[model samples]
Target: MMQFCYDDLDQWCHHCVHFVFVDEGLIAFSSFVLHLCAIKA
Candidate 1:
């Protein structure tokens, strides 16, 4: 339903520097969601 999120999902997924280092997909997903909230606010 969210084209914005779908489009940016990959970049958002990879943007989490800490998550990248730790290889934590869950953290990256959370980080991506938080980033979207911040951006939309």
Candidate 2:
């Protein structure tokens, strides 16, 4: 039972890390797009 709990916690942490990585990528992409628009204007 304890092992199962630990496995679940590990999965959760992996998902949290993945989410943060994707979120950061999105923020960077949006900022880059905005920068391009600024340059065009």
Off by over 4 Å in 1: 1-25
Best by lDDT: 1
**Tens digits of per-residue lDDT for model 2 on 1-41?**
22442355343343322332356656665455445445655
lDDT of each: 0.54, 0.44
Q: List the pairs of residues colliding in candidate 1.
A: none
lDDT (0-100) at residue 10 of candidate 1? Answer: 56
Writing each residue's lDDT as its tens digit, candidate 1 over 1-41 gives 33443466554444543443355656766775668657765
TM-score of each model, paired residue for residue: 0.38, 0.39
User: What local lDDT does model 1 show for residue 9?
Assistant: 50
Error of 2 at 1 (Å): 45
